[model samples]
Structures are given as structure tokens and as C-alpha cells.
Target: MIVTKNEAPANISKAIGQENVTPAWARAVTSFPPSDRILSTILTRQAERYGERILLVAGEARWTFAQTAAIAAASAQALIDAGIKPGDRVALMCSNRPEFLQVYLGCAWLGAIAVPINTALRGFQLSHIFRNSRPALLVVEAQFASAIESVEAGVELPPRTWIIGAAAGASDARLSAVALPARGAAAPAGAVRPGDTVAILYTSGTTGPAKGVCCPQAQLFWWGIYSARALGIREGDVLFTTLPLFHTNALNAFYQALLNGCTYVLESKFSASGFWAAARRHDATVGYLLGAMASMLLAQPQSAEDSTHRLRVALGGGVPPQIHGPFRERFGVPLVDGYGSTETNFVFAGRIPPDRPGTMGYLADGIEARIVDENDSALPDGEAGELVLRAGEPFAFATGYFGMPEKTVEAWRNLWFHSGDRVVRDPGGHYRFIDRMKDSIRRRGENVSSWEVEQTIQSHPAVAACAIYPLPSELGEDEVAAAILLEPGQSLDPVDVIRHCEGQIAYFAIPRYVRILSQMPLTENGKIKKGVLRDAGVTADTWDREAAGVKVRR
Candidate 1:
């Protein structure tokens, strides 16, 4: 539902207030030493103050704040020593691990720009990013080193620049050529500021080739502050991250943990069986999730083990607030809804209890958001329009997409960054997501929201997940087409699904074609890959469970 600018959202302040339960120490730290420090500065400070405290825990290895800082400093010095000057780009390809954090912080320390590539990408897709960023240096893992080696054979990188992790084997010549030091040394004489560009994170390649988002160091530093405040992170909190390091969610989580003087627990990836166990092992108070992560956890038939987690918060983005209550009630943990993108970081977030079902929570303090139509006219409350936001808080926005000046200009047109997302505003100033502007389906001169259709179709008892799209109709126009995933052991009967949708949705909104799949194609981040589905065409050639005309109700 679209919200008007003046309309009040349902009473959701209670939920917002509950999430603001910040600890005393975190609040004290924010006030005591009010200095503008980069992430590297925060790490160095923690090294001095909490030298013995475990700053990072991954696999069987652990690094204290002092040790982590020393390694990062040495690594930074090694890059500088290798002719990697300030502002050079460094691409990182590794799973979620301590080395990833080291690379992130180490790059910051050296004033080089970090470009973390998604570990899941392969061949041409990976090559595209490498070519786009044109990094002077690449810090890769042994497992993915071969992919880099293959790319290196064809594309030459700048001299004195390839650094591989321990996985490269102890005797490898390339590893020695780019070996990082084991101790700290004085950084080269140069001034690093918060306003300097620190990293260029590529957007998830769901729509097309990803664009590099240029985030200023000062903005990123401030992001740590706003995120910490919004999520209620604390000094003693253990932030658990299973999301890929290449993604903004994990990197932001790591930065937030460091700023709060908290311990960060790293998991190579997300697994339902090991999720809670890992949290308990590290005494983690907070965890991160995407909507698919929650659904995957929910799909794993209920067990008493489900309620055994020690997590105080499972905060992240894309979770439909519809499942928020059930997810919390089932796991005995609160799900904090936050919204951000590679282009914009943490623009809005939702708090704990009293969170209205389906709402994206309230706008973060100091951030301003509005619903504007295609003509850039601001819409009143209850109307759905393109969501635009301006930063009121520090590190709240991105400078632009690197090397794409036109794209950057387009994104930040009229002063506010265009999120390209359709959203509704409540009278209370909170925004509820409707759908992506590109994700909406147009049929019969009417707009059909895929998310609204997907939500209603998913209510079917036999359906596990659904992806709705627009397809060519006999009427020489587009019509709705839906691909559904069945609940385990449940079979898909197109006729039954049509009957179920008959009264639940409008006739125009109902899908004309229903295809069942073992699974829906998804992006690395688990968002439904509608483009892939669209390419597959509307009607199923085979594997169909119903006849051509499967109409049920009018």
C-alpha cells in the first residue's frame, strides 16, 4: 500500500522505542571522545585500550585487537612498500574470514580503496568486476587464486601487486613476491581524511553488470556511528556475521562492532544447522539476516533446538514484516528491519516489539525521506511513489557510482538519491515498501505489484515461495505469470493454485500461467531472479501438472 506524506502510519513507535535500548557504555563512548576517526583509527584505539580482548574470531584462529591492528598496519605498510600508493584500488576475493577484515581495515589504514568482490561470482561475471574496478592490487584466497591466475594470464595488473592468503601454499613464488609483513611499522607520511573515497563496493548483479558505488571514508566512518546507534550495539556485544564480506551488510556489521568496541565473530557462510550453534559458541548477542535467510531457517521443520539461541538481535534488511512476529516468536529473538543499498547505506530501519507487520520501520533519526511521483512531485501520505532520501546524519550517503558520472548524476538528481523503490508513507513518517520500480509488472493498462502478488500467492498452504512477472498475452499485451515453489512433499497443481488465488486477488492481478519449479533462480543475495524467469518464457513446455485452461473461479 502506498502511503501519503501527511498520513500517520499505524502505531509503531512502541517497536521503534524498544530497539533503542542502548547500553550505558556505548552511549558513554559516543560522548567521551568526540573525534572524527576512520575505521583504522578505531581499530588502533581498540588495540591500545583492549589489547588482550579478542577482536576477531574465525574458524580455529583468533586475533586480539592488538594483534589484528598490528597485522593490519603491517599489511598496510606492505602495500605501501610494494608501490601501492594512496587512492589505489585493491580488490579482495575471500569468504567471510578474519583475513577479509584485515584487508578492509588494512586498506583503510593505507588510504587505498578496497574493492571486495563477491566470492560466489565466477568466470565472466567475476571478470567484469575486475575489469571495471581496474584495481592495482588483488588480495585473494588460495581457493579462488586459480580464478585470478586465469584472469591474470590474459589481463595484466600493475606491477608489484598480487597478494594471496596462506591458501596459496607456503612455497609459492607469487605469495613471496607479494608477502605482507607480520608486524606494525610507521605509515607513510600522508594525510587521510573522512572525506576521502575509502571503498568502491559493487551493487549486487541482479539486474545487470554491477556498478561501483563510491563511498567516502568520512561517510563510512559516520555510517559506523549511525548503524551502532540504530542497532543498539554495545562495547561487550558479540556481532555475528554470516553474510559475505563483499556485501555491505557484513562490512557495515564489522565496522559497527569495532566502533562499539565489540567482538566480531566470523562465519564462512550461512547454514541453518550451524547458525545458532555458532552464535552460542561465540556468545554472540546479535546476528544479521536477509529475507531468504529467515525463510530458509523457517523451512527447516521446527525442533526444540530452534529456541536455544542466545542472540539478542537478528538485525538486517529485506525481511517482510509479515514474518517478523512469527520468526521472533518461533526463535525467541527480535528481528530488526533495516533498509540500505550499495549506493545508500542504512537509510531507514525498524525497531523491536510494536513493529507494525509489513512496515519497514521508522526513518532513522536525522535522515529525511519522501515519496515522489515520476515527475518528482512529492506525494502526500498513503500514496505510493519513488522513495528518495537525503542524509541528515553522518556517512549516510554515497558520493556516487565510480567512473559512471552520468549514472551518478542520475541517481542523485534533484539533491536526493533515487532509490528506485516504490514505497508508502504512514502518517508517523515511516515508509513501508511496496515493490521495486523495475520489479513492478504492468498488465492491461494496470500496475500489478509483484511483491503484493507474491505475498498473497505465498499464503497458499502448499506454496513455499513465489516469483510473479509480466508475460506476453494473447491480447497482444502483458499478463501476469507466476512461478511457485511447493512446500516439501507438497505437489503443485496449477488448477488448485488458480482456485486459491481466485478470491484472494483481483482478476487482472491473478496469474494466467503458473509454473512449478524445484527452486526459483536467485541472486547471490537470495532475491528472486525475475530476469532469469522472464527469459524462460511464460508457458511451461513440460513438467506441468495441469491442462492448458486451468481457470477455477471468475
Candidate 2:
């Protein structure tokens, strides 16, 4: 049913604290008309509706809905002045800040594609993104200039580089460095379609370089709507997030606020000690967190301020089921577990006050999910297999992997996006996550590619062969583990293995546990038996980087 402004359901009205809030499911079935779903259009509409209401807060900087819309328009003018055109790729590498949003929103306003790169990416990983995306312009923080310089020898970076912060002494001969241009006169929003690509979010590849998930204009609109519904966001509520803006979680939090007529706050980074204080300071009613973040907060010494925050709930996906009750009891805020990826929308979410603690909530409306076997045959309920999903709303999910047609086809085979996550749906329709079916490790909320880690480890002088896999972490999620075979007659220190990986990959992707083996277990075809290594797990001889007092800093 097409719900108009006056026909909002009473339950949704109570949930959002407003009578005009549109339910996401209703928006999905109505074709998500471009005038309503496109980012530029959404911003314009919200600005007109909300007027001067505060829309975004980053540190001490604040922008109202109208101001944000103006910033986006001005940013679009700046991009156009820099020679950016519709559909051109603009690479952005920076920490969470207002400039990131300005650039992202500007891209949306101008119909350009924003490619937000993880700031921690360097060397091989960073170079691969530059080579693959081939962005027309690079907008990066001055602090990350060295990262770009590190890869300049091999990769042809964007033709122009615009530095965000102080770049006085950070200049490089190879880079065409220039100060970030001032915002130009406001430009009109572009005529963007719902299916037009808005952003290219790169997710870790299991056996290859990271693939850029092409997020369409309407997909982000759905993300804003669906995620707001999942968090039970209300009008005039303050939504705060410490997650990086480069990822989907934080970016969508902005949308959640935009669509729900709420205020959004962005922190520079996550700090377990200061989390509650910040929330209380902002008078935040809703928050966002990953599973590992919940564990980190639990590890902090309890204080009287723990339950003092106004935050009533948080979108806590991947949180360990065991800690759900305890976390709520101590913090007085319930964590809502759900299932989502860069390639998918908010597909599964638990109830507000969940009946089941650990399971990913019942499948969401406007989507179809199936547990499928190796041959793509659907499995019965209660049987664990790869979870595949299909969205009913057009352009609600990511279109495909940019520049990787083969990977796109492989992932979207049989008309369903292969999640590569093992899960089982009970008769009651609740889904429980099993394990990852693909060869990837998730550590501290970052997806670590086994292929990328193995490649980095194999580059060490004394390493002959290596297999990277996941070992269960005490703080929920996985800890990267490396099983290595030494080169003949060559001696290698386990600590050096980590030192070798220092600048080659992300700090989270570095091996936490290293086991040096004399010989690798092999298959009939001479392939290294990674499953055997994973099953062997952390052995007595495993050298733990944390236990040895080795620290890796970003």
C-alpha cells in the first residue's frame, strides 16, 4: 500500500514520535520513486520539512538540515569547479569528520560516485584500490599523505590531490598536492535516478583484492529507512555513532537521522572509557555499535555513569549472545542484533526487546532469504548453510561489484546475493549465525582477507608458505591466526613476522597468533589444507603477539 503523509499507522507514529514517519516496508513496495529515494532529493525534501532543525553534529561543528543541504550544494559546486562530472569517481581517504560527509553528500548531490577508502589501508592494499577505482580526483586528509606517497611508486594515483588539513610540510614531489578548495556557490541538485550508483564501498575479498560494492542511490535511502526502523529511532531523537564514516554503519547512521527527522552525532573514534560520557553529553537517545565494541565496553571498569546515559538502545550487530542480558542489565540500554553487509541492506533485525538473545531476528519484510547447500539447492529450516538473500524493492541492495564483473556474477548467481555466511533458520523463523563459509576473518569489526594476509606473510624473507585463518576471540568475533612453514634452513623470529606486516596491511588484519610449522598439511592436488590448519587451531607452540607485549598502532 502507498502510505501518504496523512495515512501513517498508529504503531509507527508512536515509535517515531511523529505522525508523518513513513514505514520502510511501505516505502519499499511503492517502487521507492526517485524523487523520494534519491539522496539529493531526500536532502532537499528533509531540509524543506525540518527547516532549521539540527541535523548533524561532528565534534564541536554542527549543521542543520537546511545548512547541510546548503553544504552539499556548495560542495557539489566545488567538485564541479575541480572538473568532477556526473559518474566520475572521487576517492576519499580520511578519518571521521565533517569534510568526509561534505564530500560524500556533494558526490550524491552531483551524481558523482564517492569512493571512501579506509584510512588504515596502505602499501599493497591501498595501491590496489587506486589501480582498480582509478578515481578522477583524490580528497585525502594531510595526515594520510604518507600512505598515498607509499603507493605512488607503483600505482598511478588520481590526477589531482586535495589535502583537507595542514599540508604545509607534508608536500610530496610526486603528488600534485593542493589545499582543499573553499566551498563554491551553491549548485542545484543533479537529476539523479534511484538506480544510479552513489558510492563504491570496498569490502574485503576472501581470495582476492577487495571488491567495491556499488551502492545505488535508492539503496542508501532504504538503508536510512530500514536501519531507522530497526533501531526504533524517533523524531527529535539524537543518534550518535563512533564508527568510521568510511564504512556503511556510520554512513547509514547519517541517513537514519536524515530520514527519521532526528539529530546525528559523529565522534572521531570509538573509546570504551568515554563512550557513556559522550552519549550522556550529547543527550543521545540512540547509538550504534559492532559486536566487538560491546565487548570492549564490558571490559572497562564499571562506573556510576554506566547507566546514566540517555541512550535507550543501540544497533549492536555481531554482539555475543552471552553478554546481551548482562550488557543491558549493567548499561540499561538494550543491544539490537541484526544481519547486514556492505553488499546488502538491513536484512534481519531482532525485536525492540528481543525474546531470543543471540539469534539474528526474524527475516525483515520486503526481502526473501534461503539457506542453500553447496549446489545452490535450498535447505530446510533448522539446517545450517550459506545464507542467500534477495530484496523485493528495486535498487534497495547494492547493484554489483564495480569493475569486477566475474565476482559480481559469482556473488549474485541464481538471482540471490550469496552472503557467504553460514546460518540456520528455525521453524519460528529466527536465524542463528553459524560461521563464515568463505575464507575471511573478522577482527574488531574489520573484515580481514585471508588471501591478503597470506600474501603479506608470504613476502617475509624466511617464510615459505602460510595460511591465514580465524581463531575464536575472547571478546567476540575472530582473531587473525597465521600458520606458517619456514624456508629451508632459514631461521625466522615470530615477532619479525608481525614486523614484516606492519605497513603492508591494516593493523587489525595482522596475525594475533603465529604458529611456525616445519611442513604444511597438503591435499592430493598439492593445495595447502587450510581447513586442517584451522581445525588444529592455536597450538602450544603458538606465539601470541598480545602476550609478548607487541603493540600495533594505526
Candidate 3:
């Protein structure tokens, strides 16, 4: 099922227009392959078909499909030389770079599972993953070695380690020492299958210890195909992302580009001010927006460069409603926000008949999804419920949480992959995201969507980014609390914030305590660490309208 450059995909009809995401078309176009997909095979096919076509670009470095394939093959030999065996987990703890690709694809070449660790994780959090995965080999960026070493006092690190981008240390051999050229044959043909584990990415763990998500080789291929087709990604489209490679978002982008014979542009991190300029420079035709990226882009000084790029559409999930349309109009590029996760990549995206602004698009291909209640009964359309999805084919979804059978069984209860997200499906055949089941807040005997609260407050003129969560109250229920980041050169009084919410939201949903931060503390995956904010509740510097005797009326 590997797509050769410009070759017609099997079972797919002529490409549908942007407006067509119907289940009928999904069934027609997505013919799941009979054989299990292997990433090594896909890369080899792409190289043979595309050859000199540029597939990856970072800074001034541009790698054609042939070159990338070669490096990956050589990288596999390096892993083998390091005694990495098939099925052994090789932990990769590096920032986004060409090297990350080498190791990730290299491991795939050997059927060694790549464990891409979030680079931002430190100390205790970092140790938890090491203890859990227990990878045989650890490939780390030189900068993080000290922090990784610090955790080794109490926990066992991987037995073997390779330092990339090593700064003059006359000690350990750098991975480059054992590297081979890509043209060299490394392993036997068809040594792996699509069902074989390719990667084990650690979850952000909003509520508990991070679990490793087992992503099969086939799942990543499906993600790329789903993303490319859903967003109408053209052959010349250069998929751009500033998200970390450790996350599924970037990996999907990379594979999406390769799967379609397009180029992929990677950046170390996102920059709001220079975003459009960079897009223009790269001739980026498509990109991704996530978390508060869209909001931050809107906050940047409006420039003519916004519309100057070849960039046309951006794919993402969870864009703030108030800015969703405005961002498109202002930048002259449409943003298609979808909803999915590490477990299921891009299950729903912008579909036919166009959804109401703020809705989380319609369903995507190859899956049967539903909104269900606590008892697993399907809820009527427009009723808020948990979103559970099941793939038509096995291994299309993540196998399960790695090594956690109890949790896996619990999550996949009743034979549905529970998403733990609250959403509403429209009778008109669209869907709207409500909130995370775990992140909901109870106030004044009413369940308030923290997502709704955050979106409303984020629309304020001065607010840059925010997280609204429940703060424990002596009265038995939770009180609303907001940890906010103000726009540069903007300021607001806590009283004004309460007043702003007076008519906009439920009276009970208004924040009682406001903690303004220069920047929101984020998880390794760039999601706001609401749990950390909840733990650091109402400091001396926190503004309390109730303590100040400010009256709030319903």
C-alpha cells in the first residue's frame, strides 16, 4: 500500500474535493491493505519512486528521499553494531533535528522499537519513563545528559547510551563512530510487519504516571494517509511543524509529507512573530497549529507577510472558537482543526457541509466513532458524552498502553477505544468538542466545561493563553481558578476578569482566584500543565476577588 510518487493509490477513486468527507467516500477510498505495513518498506519504496525529490528540510539542510533512505539504512547498521536487537526498545531523547529522523527510521529498519522521549521532561518525570520502558539503549542529545545522569542515582538508566551533538568530551564514543552509509544493505528483506511495534511514545499523563503508547508501524502509515487525504494535502505541499518530534503531531507531519512525495520543514520551536516570514521563506503550503499556537499567532503584530506565503491550509486540533475564523480571515489561510490523540491519530477533521465555527469538525476515514455515556450506551446527537472510536481494521488504532494490561482493558472496555474526551455530535452530521472528562470542573452544583471557560477568557483583548481548572473549596465543591498569561504590554485587574465573565458564562463558572503568569508552565508535549497549576493554588500573589469583598452578581 506504499504510494509511489504520482502513482494512483489502490481502491481510491479520483481525489475528492475539500468538502467531501462523507462515510461513503471514506469507505470507497480507504482500502486497508491485507498485509501488515512496515515503515522500512514505505521508506524504501518512497526512495525508489521519488529518488531526488526533497523530502525533509531544516535550516539550510535539504535531504532528498534517496539520501534520507540511505542515512536511515546506515543508522540501522549503527544500532546493530551497538548490539540493539529486533524488538529491543531504543530510547531517543533528542530535540527535533535530522539526527532524530536517522535514529527513528534506523530502528524501524531493524524492527527495533523507537521510544521517543519528550525532551522537556526532567528529574522525577524523566526517571519514571526510564523505569517504565527500561530501554536497552539510550540515545540522548548532549545537552540533556546532565539531567538524565542526575536521575540515575535512584533509577537504572539504559545499559548503553549514545550522545548526539556531543560537545568536546574525550570519553564516550559518539554514535557517528559506528555509522554506515545508506547504500549498504543492513538487514534481510521483510523482517518486520505493520503490527510490529515501531515506537513507544510516553503520554503527557495529566492525572497519573505517564504510560507508553505502543504505536505499530502500520498505525503511523495510516496516520500519514489520513492526514494527507483529510486536509487535501497536494503533492507540492510542504508540511511544516514546530512541534517537537517526540509527539505524534510532528511524526504524522513528517510521514504525511513522505507518503505524498512532498517536502517537510521542521523548526526547533514555534515563533509567533516570525512565523509567517518563515513560512514564506520555506514556501510552506501546509502546516499544523495546536494548543494555544493559533491564539499566540493572533496576538502577534498583524503583518502583510501573513498572506504572502504559498501556505494555504493549516491542520490542527483544539483551536479557540473566538479566533478560529478570525485567524483564517486575517491570515488569508484556512485552519482545519480536527480532534484525535496519540491513541488515534486524526479521527475527525473538517468534513462535508462545513461545521459551525468552534465545532471540532466531522469524522475521518476507517473508523466507527460514537459519543457514549458512562454505561457505554450511545447518546443522542448534540448530547455531550465520551467519545469512543473503534477502527474498522485491527492495529489501526494504537495496540494499547504499553505493558499496562489492566489500564488497557479498562480503556478498551466494551471493545471501544475510549478517548476520555467529552464531545457532542450534531444531528446535521458534525461534532463539537466539549472538554476532557478528567479536566471538567464542578461549581455551584453545575458541571462547567473548563475548555469553554478558557476559550471565553482567552478571547479577551489582553489575554495571551490560559488554563481554567477547579480549585478545592471548603464548601465541598470546586471553585473556578484561572492561571493566565497576559499579552505583551497588556494588563488586567482580577475584578475586571470576573466582570468580563458576568454575562458571557454561567455565574458559577467565573474564576474566584486569578494567578497571572509570564508564561504558562507546559508539559513535555506542550500541553498546559493544569495539574501543576492546581497543585500551586492561590499563592500570596494570587488575586482573590472574594477576599477583596468584590460582589459578583448572577
By TM-score, who's the top model here? 2
- Model 2 residue pairs with clashes: none
lDDT-based ranking:
2, 3, 1
Q: Can you write out model 3's per-residue Cα lDDT over 1-554, one digit (the tens) per residue? A: 11001112222223335343333214312433536367777678778878999999976679999988887777888788778889999988888888889889889988899999866555455677888888988888777565564353558767677777764332333223222223355654338888889999876443455678999888888788778766777676788898889989899888888777789999887888878888888888888887467777888887766677887778746565666677878887777767677887777776422345556676665678878889988888768898888877557789888878887898899888888889887665577777667776655334456765786688889999989887876443477899889999999888888887664554666788998898888988999988889888778878887899988764
| Predicted candidate 2 versus true structure: per-residue lDDT over 163-223, tens digit per residue | 9986533455667878788887998988889999999999999989999999999889888
Best by lDDT: 2
Each model's C-alpha lDDT? 0.69, 0.86, 0.74
* Candidate 2 Cα RMSD after full superposition onto the native fold (Å): 3.7
lDDT of 1 at 454: 78
- Encode model 1's per-residue lDDT on 1-554: one tens digit a residue: 22222222233322335344555334534643434456566677767877888878888778888887777777788677767878999888777767777777778887899998766444344566777888887777766665544342355443443444652232323333344345457564235766677889876322344578988775665566657665666677898988777877778776776667788887988897778778877888888877557766776778887878678887746655566777888998787776776677676766655356445767765567779999888888888899987876555578888887878898899988888889887776677887667665645433455765676688888999998886654332356788888999998677777666654444556787778889889999998888888777854442222346555443
State candidate 1's TM-score. 0.74
The estimated TM-scores of all candidates read 0.74, 0.95, 0.75
Which regions of candidate 1 deviate over 4 angstroms?
1-35, 149-190, 205-208, 439-539, 542-554
